[model samples]
Target: MYILQTVVVKQVLTEKMKRQLLLSYEEQKSQLQREYEQLRFEQKKAEKKYKNSKKESAQLYEKEMQKRLDKIQNIEFQVNQLSLLPLGSELKEQELQTMTEVNVGDRWSDIENEKTIIIKDGIIIDIR
Candidate 1:
């Protein structure tokens, strides 16, 4: 009877140890699963943030390029205006001596009375 009791107690202890070990393993697995879920959430958030930053960067770059293009167009227009001025001046100088003198009591001719001149789009016009 003493031997039989000892064996029964040993079997109970072994079963308790197995149950505890199984519970410990389950707890560890649950904790690791939670950690993995948290890591996945953080990664998703980081990816969204990165994508937003990239889009903003691209928009900024496009705006900068547009501004540069506008500036270049303005400079080109100014250069074209500057280039036409000398040619207009040379033409006006050639015509200076050919202008006929008109008296105050003349026939009021349209060609002789025109004085104010304007140049636009490379065309010269006389404005009275």
Candidate 2:
């Protein structure tokens, strides 16, 4: 029989990989900052256009703006942590669903233990 299994993909942080990750994080921060600015602009415009409903409109826009600001802060923290970590640190990158074949007598422990894939410099280095 075959079943779908969750596999973990980990990345080994080399210098190149670290730089790439930092760049990606910076890009995310920039986009979020833009979004935050846009939200502020919209909120001000809304307040100017609708004096009677200014409080409600401002609250709604503030909530969305806060979400974006929180994300930017999180990404900033990740960037700082990543910069402090040394090379060869392992980071859990993502998870993937894969098809696996199972026999009647297969050991569940073994199958579960072998679900991690390690990547370095964009290439897979190990599966364990």
Candidate 3:
């Protein structure tokens, strides 16, 4: 499904907001790091536990290990994308779809989403 994300206003970013966003990003990145470490530890633990278990238990733990690996991959992707947030940029994401009508705006897109569009004066602005 397509979701409308990332709204940016022209020249509204302030130093204080930028600092706050940086701090928030730092915290989130650190949290992700900690989660990644925990996942690694759990994967190792599972490996050791299943190393000598019966065939059935080995299969079960192998599935569990795969799940952990997938979760780790997802978290890593999120962590990497965290750095790309428009924290200090001119654009901020439109968190809600309350903007039913706009006069003129621009449109752009990213890797997963399409078209950052701005509408103003009943006209669509393609900013991408």
Index of the highest-lDDT prediction:
2
TM-score for all models, in order of appearance: 0.30, 0.91, 0.42
Q: Each candidate: RMSD to true structure?
A: 45.7, 1.5, 10.1
Candidate 1 structure quality by residue, lDDT tens digits, 33-97: 56555655655565677885765555554565555456555555644554444322322222222
Ranking under TM-score, best-scoring first? 2, 3, 1
Model 2 steric clash pairs = none
Q: Which is superior by lDDT, 2 or 3?
A: 2
The segments of candidate 1 whose C-alpha lies over 4 angstroms from its true place after superposition are: 1-13, 52-128
Backbone clashes per model, in order?
0, 0, 22
**Candidate 1 local Cα displacement, residue 11, angstroms:** 13
> Considering lDDT, which of the candidate structures 1 and 3 is the better prediction for this target?
3
lDDT per prediction? 0.44, 0.91, 0.52
- What clash count does candidate 2 reach? 0
